[model samples]
Target: MGVKNRIFKYYFPQKAVDLKQKRRGNCNGIVLMYHEVLEDSIDIPAWTIVKRSNFEWQMKYLRNNFDVVTMDEATKRVCGLSEGQRPFAVVTFDDGYKGNFNNVLPVMNKLSLPFVVYVATKAVSDSSIYWYDKIIGLLDKRDDLFISIEGDDIPIRKSHSNSKRWSLMQKALSKLKSMSASERDIEVKKILDENDARSFSSRIGMLSASDLGAMSKHQLVTIGNHTHGHELLDQISGLEIYNTINKANCLIESWTGIKPKHFAYPNGNYSENVLDALSAFGFSTLVTTKPGIWDGSRSLMEIPRLGIGRFETKSQFKARLAGFL
Candidate 1:
């Protein structure tokens, strides 16, 4: 094991014990969220990616020290059902990265652990890459681009680097949201071409239809809808949001031969209308990016999750998982 992995292994168990003690009777269960399981390098911001080694170490810790369960079982137990059940954890990944199938699933299989992956179905069919990836790639290559939003121009500076680009991208995307769909598409296309990101295909290595089908067959893996295009529901109309999520659910069902029961909001920011729309669609549970423990008494629509990413050390990982930080 590397230094980080060794350190994490040593501290993770103690952190879990401390968290368990802190929560006492109030501790329900933990819903762990992951994005990409990178082999050695994760190019994204530190807060958004976790290395494969760390992930494996974390899973091993769970296997040794906690009863890890599926999202459905954890939800049921939290809801006062499944009496006499022991404390457990649920593992979930968002944005169905191709890496999940390539890197995450193997580890999961080795550990015989159950996990849920929330996939953005639109990307499965699109040849182009996700816009966020394009943005990141652009920022990585060009440091001199000035992103203008509503007449305010922000130059990408080297000192702030990733943070500045992320903020600017958010502002730019918000501006795009205000435009009509066709207009937004035109604007995005222009941005991508200008950034020389047109050659980068987001779907180049993503999970194919067959891959999803095979994954769904595993009893340990459950698929969930993350929307058609992974749009931020709070920024879009209720009808658009509903259609996106519903479409993803349909596509996943067509591929997997099973209708997904769970939904995770893209970006995990939803308005009241989005929640109502989900309820209307007969969704039993939804996951959010907000961080907190799962209590049965909370709203089924606003489930919070602790995000794991590249910057997390083993100590930090344990601290976050144990609810210590």
Candidate 2:
């Protein structure tokens, strides 16, 4: 919920939230978006990752309480192809982290949970550290750091340790969104080049091509497209949107022998233009970062997803699923 909903729910219309929850029938479903599933700590914001144990507990909670479904099942429910007789939920991971194979797949297998992992093809095929992870990886290795954003040189003196650097950079990284895709890439390259930064290994980076094939063969796992380079479609040109989608689609098909019909916009950054482009590419559905229950009221291409992050206890997860988010 946004500020408007919060104010209305608390100060004015106290029953508004309850009424909204009450109206959520069997047709409505919640899509949970996750980024990295790591067993160890990462030098990034905790909100971007969930530890292995926490994710397991979350799976147990969902299995016990909700009708966890696959993306195919979800599409049917949302598109009215299947009888939506009960509240449903879908678990999805944005980036194809190696943990999806090493850590996550085991847990999902143990729980028999159906989930989706949207893979950015380049990361897997080329074994590249995602741009965002590259930035964090480079910064995490240095205690004294200077970043050149635009013409400004911002220096960090106190951000020496891993936690401190992560906390400091979390806020600083958002500013890069203002720059053009080329501009941001150029600046990131400059910083890393001067610092002699090496890209993080795919062993701890993205899912490999083998992982893609493995997940594709799993009965409960569906591989989806993230993009070729994890490009923010709105920040780049329409040509980029066209090219990235096609390239990703092709690569995913080559690896998995099946083209993905669903996609997740990079960083959840998308507009109607992006949606139209995705639709033109024949993508059946796409998800956004916006938090809410999807009840077929919005465009299927712009489905809202609830983001689940680090250290989210079972109770907190239950409440969000219960529509108290």
Candidate 3:
């Protein structure tokens, strides 16, 4: 281990112990949200794109100290349906990144850890990559390019290196958020072509049907629907949003022989209509990217999660997981 990692591990145990003492007898569980577990850094710079070594360490720590459970178990505990004195944890990955199948699943299998994977169903069946991935890949290829959205000219700086790309992409994507769907698609296509980069589809490949099938068969994994297309629920009509979620659940059930009972909002943002739609579809629980501990009083449809990323050191990881910081 490096000096920093060694130091983190040395100091983390005391921090965990301190937190445990302060919140004595609090029956709370943590739902950790991870996107992609990668061996090498990708174009995106979010801390949640955790390195393989760090991810392994985090999992090892959890295995050694906590009783990691599935989303189903966490839901049951939150609903007062399970008898348990031991603390619980649930691991989930959003967006169905191919990396989840290629890299994360093997580690999980080796440890016999159970996890939940929420997928964007349309992306799974199609060759398209998620829009966010496409944006980052385009920016990575060209530093001289300037993206103009809504009369705002945002310069793409060469100095914004790989480590800073996620911040830059967030700013750029925010600008496009105001555009009509057709207009945004046109602009994104042009940007990709100008830089000789493949659109999102060619950048981060989605999980194939076979990959989903294999993952479903694993006793350690559960699949959840993340909408047919990752549409912002608040912006679309109620019926449209319902259809998106319903289609995804139907597709997953056909593929896996199990209808998913859990749902995760796209972008971790939702509307009242969205929640009602999930309830109408018979969803027992829903998860969001917001950070906090679950104490069973929060809305089951909007349970929060602390998103883990690349910037988190081992100490920070432990602190967050232990609810110390």
Best by TM-score: 3
Better of 1 and 2 by lDDT: 2
Model 3 misplaced stretches (Cα beyond 4 Å):
1-13, 16-18, 21-26, 41-48, 139-145, 198-203
RMSD of each: 4.8, 4.6, 4.0
lDDT per residue (tens digit) for residues 258-289 in model 2: 99988898888998788777777777788888
What TM-score fits each model?
0.82, 0.83, 0.87
Model 3, 15-104: lDDT tens digits are 565567347332568888998887765544554467777788889887765668987777777778884566677889988988888888
Better of 1 and 2 by TM-score: 2
Clashing pairs in model 1? Answer: 49-309, 49-310, 129-202
lDDT of 1 by residue, 70-156 (tens): 888877778877743345788999888777888889999999999999989887877345765555455545346555544566566
Off by over 4 Å in 1: 1-16, 19-22, 41-46, 83-86, 139-146, 151-187, 199-205
Assess candidate 3 and give its lDDT.
0.76
TM-score, candidate number 2: 0.83
Off by over 4 Å in 2: 1-23, 41-45, 138-148, 151-167, 193-204, 311-315
Error of 2 at 12 (Å): 22
